[model samples]
Target chain A: MIHPLAVSHDFGVWVGALLTLMVFSFLYRDNPFYKFAEHVFVGVSAAYWMVIGFWTTLWPRVIVPLIPEASRIVSSDTPLPERDLSAVVPAVLGLMMLSRLVPRLSGLARWPTAFVLGTTAGYAVVRYVRSDFMHQIQATIGDGVLIPAAGGGWNVAESLAALVTLSGTIFGLIYFMNTRRGGTVTTPAARIGLLVLMVTFGASFGSAVMARISLLVGRLQELLGDWLGLL
Target chain B: MKRPTPQILLTGVALILVVAAFMAPPGDGSSGGFAGAVTYADRHFSSWFGILAVFAFLLGGASLLRTHGRRVRERKADWHYSAVTLVSFLAVLIVGFLKLGGPPGLTGDPTDASSWLTTIFDSVLSPLHATLYSLLAFYVASASYRAFRARSLETSVLLGAALIVLLGRIPVGVTLFRFDSLSLWLLKVPNTAGQRALMIGVALGVVALAVRMVLGLERGRGGDGS
Candidate 1:
C-alpha cells in the first residue's frame, strides 16, 4: 500500500477509477451518473464486440475467402482461404439474415434462421443424450450395492452410504420428471429429492457468492492499490 | 412449424445432421471413407454456424441504432442518454475500424496494445464491466437476506448448507467451525447426486425439444411467429 498522496497520475488509471466509482454509485439508487455509465457501457461493449467479430469471424471466414485479393489489407500472414467455394454458402446465408432490415423481404431471413436452429437442434439432441443422459446416469449409479472394502471383505457401512446415494439420485430424478404429474411417483422419495435439490441449490448459491466476492475483492484491490494508492 | 417451407428445411437439416452424427463412424472421421465425408460436412456446418452467429452482432447494432435514433428524433424520455449511447458506440466503432493510433490499415489489429481502442477498452469498458459483475456480490447478499427471512424447514436446510459451505471456504470460519470436512462431504455426495439427477432431467427435456423441432411440431426460438 502506498500513500493516497502518492497516487499515480496516469490518465487511464484515473479514467478507470472514475468509471468504477460511477458504477458503484448504482448502489445508492438510480441516478443520472449511474444511467450515463450504464449507457456508455452498453454502447462501448457492443461496439467492442462488433469490432472483434469483424476482425475475427467476418474478416477471415467470409472476406478473405470470398475475395482473395482483399487479403493484402487483412494482414500479410492471413492464410489465403483454404476452403474457397464453401465460404460462399455461409456468406450468402449471412446476407439473407440482413434481409430482415427491409419490411417486405423480412421473410427471406427465415431460411438462415431455419438452418441455424436446425443444426443446433441436431447437435443438442445427440449431445444431451450421450453426455447428460447416459453418462450422468452411469456415473450416478454405476457403483454396485455391495461396496468393496479397503481390506478384504465387503464393507457394510460403505455399502449403506452407496445405497443412500443411489436412492437420492433416483429420488431426485423422480422429483424432476414426475413433479407436475402428481402421481404415485410423488412419494416420500420426492420429498427427499426436494431436500437434496435444496441442498444443491444452497451449495450452488454459496459457490456463486465465492465467485462474485472474488471479483468484488479484485475491483476493491484495484481501486485501493492502483487508483487511490492506499491498498 | 406452421410455416411449410422453413419447417421442412428445419426438419430435413436436423434429421440429416442427427443421422450423420450418430451413424457416421466416430473418431473425427480423419481416414478416407464415407465417414470422412460426413465428418467434414459436420465440421464445415459448425464453422458456418459460427459465421452465422456473428451476424447477430450486426442485427444487434442495427437494432440499437434504430431504437436510439427514433428516441432522439422524437425527444422521448432519457433522450440524452440515447444520444450518449450513439456517440460512444460510433466513437468506438470509428476509432477501432480506423485503427487509430496503431498500424494504419484495414487489416491492422484495432485492439492491438498500442491502439486507442485498446486504451478505451482498458480504462473505460473493462472497469465498467468488472464493476457491473462485482455488483452481483452485493445483490447476492441482499437476495440471501430476503430468502433467509422465510421461516421454513426448506429455508433452514438451505441456510444450514449455505452457512457450512460459506464458512468452510474462509480461513477464520474454518478454524472456528471445522466445517471443511462436512462441506466436502456435502458437495461430493449429495451435490453430485442432485446435479446428476438434474442433468438427466434437463437432457430428457432437450431431447424432447429436439425431437419436436425435427418433426416440425415446434419452432420455438427462431420461429418468429411464422
Candidate 2:
C-alpha cells in the first residue's frame, strides 16, 4: 500500500540520499528543496562553529581562567591555575567587540578589530617575509647553474631549469610593475612574463579541475555505493 | 597637545599588547616569573582573540535570527523559506544545546558519537556540504570550455598547456601522448617561477599593510576594504 514516492527505510542512507538529491537538483534549476537544504546547511554549520568554539576555546581559555570553578567542570582530570588576570585583557577587548551591535557604541568595536589587525599584520610581516620572499629568493639564487657537481660533470637539464626559473621569476616581477613607461627591453620581459603567467594559470586550472572532479566522484560514490548499495 | 579619544587609547593599548605578545621570546623551560608570564600571555593572545571572535559570531547569529524572525512575522515574499531557515537553525541549536541522546552531564559534548547532533552532522550536513561543493565540478567544466577558447596566441598556449597538464595527471595521457615529462618541465620551471614571483609580491604587500596598521594609518577598524 506504500506509494512509489517513498524513500528507503535505512535511516542514514535515507537522510543522506535526500540531502544529496536536493543539492544536485540545483543542476536542473533552483527550487524550494534546494533552498531548504542550502539554508539548513548554513544554519547547522554556523551553530557547529559556535558550539565548537565555545567548548574548545572560550570556555577553557577565557571563561575558566576568569571563573576558576569552570575549569574543573570543563575538564575534571587536568589541574589548572585558579585565576589569570591576563585573560581579563582579552575578555575586556571581547566585550568591547560586542559593542558593535549598538549603532553609537560601534566605534568602540574598532579597538578590538585594530588589535586583531595589528596582531595579524605584525605576525604576517615576519612570516611572509621569511617564508615566501626570503626563502623563495634564496632558493632561486642558490641553485648551481654555472658550478658543476663534485663529480665535475655539468648537468645540462639542471642548468637549463635553473636559468628558466631565474629568468621567469625576474620577468614575472617585471610584468607586475606598473606606473613606469615600457622600454624595448622591458616590453620583451613583460611579454615573457605573460607567457610564464599563462602557463602557471593553466596548470593551476587543470589541478583545480582534477580536485573538483574528485569531490564530485566522492558524492557520486556515496550516492551509488552507500545509499543505493549498487557500487 | 590634543587629548586622545577612547578609540585611539584603546587602539594604542591593543597595539602595544599585540606587538609585545608577538615579540615575546619563546619559553625554553629554563625561565620563569616575568618570562613565564610573557610566554603565557603570548600563547593565550590568539585564543583570547578567538573568544572575541565568538562574541562576533554571537552577534552574527542574533542578526540572522532577527532578520529571519522579522521575515516570518511580516510574511514577506519567500517568507516560507525564512520559516524553514529559522526552524532549521533552532532545531540544530536546541538539539545541540540540550545534548539529546548524549551522555548525562551538563557540559558533556553534544557531538558525542551517539548524539543527534553527530547523526545530523554525519547524515545530513556532510552529504549536503559535499554535494553542494561537487556542483563546482559542473561549473568549472563549463567555465573552462567557455573561457579557454584558442582565439589568440596567448589563449592557444594557455589552452594547450591546460590540456597537456590535465592529460598528464591521468593515466591515458602517459600511455598515448607522453605528457608527463612536458607537464613536469612546465610546472617545475615556469609555474614555480611564476608562483615565487607572486609570493614575493604578496609578501611585500602584506608587509606594507601590516606597517600601515601598526602605524595607525589604516583607520577603518581593519574592515575597510582597501
The most accurate candidate by TM-score is 1
What's each prediction's TM-score? 0.91, 0.86
Off by over 4 Å in 2: A1-9, A72-81, A146-152, A178-186, B1-23, B28-41, B220-226
Residue-level error in angstroms, candidate 1, position A224:
0.6
Interface RMSD (Å), every candidate = 1.7, 2.9
- lDDT tens per residue, model 1, B60-168: 8888999999999999999999999999999999987777787666666877897888999999998888899999999989988987864977788888888888889
Global fold similarity of model 2 (TM-score) = 0.86
Error of 2 at A29 (Å): 1.1
Q: How far is candidate 2 from the true structure (C-alpha RMSD, Å)?
A: 4.4
Per-residue lDDT of B57-104 in model 2, one digit per residue for the tens?
A: 777777788888999999999988888778877887777766666776
Top candidate (DockQ):
1
Residue-wise C-alpha lDDT for candidate 2, range A134-164, written one tens digit per residue? 9999998886466475688877778888988
Chain B vs. true chain B: TM-score per candidate: 0.86, 0.80
Error (Å) of candidate 2 at residue B121 is 2.2
Model 1 chain B worst lDDT window (10 residues) = B217-226
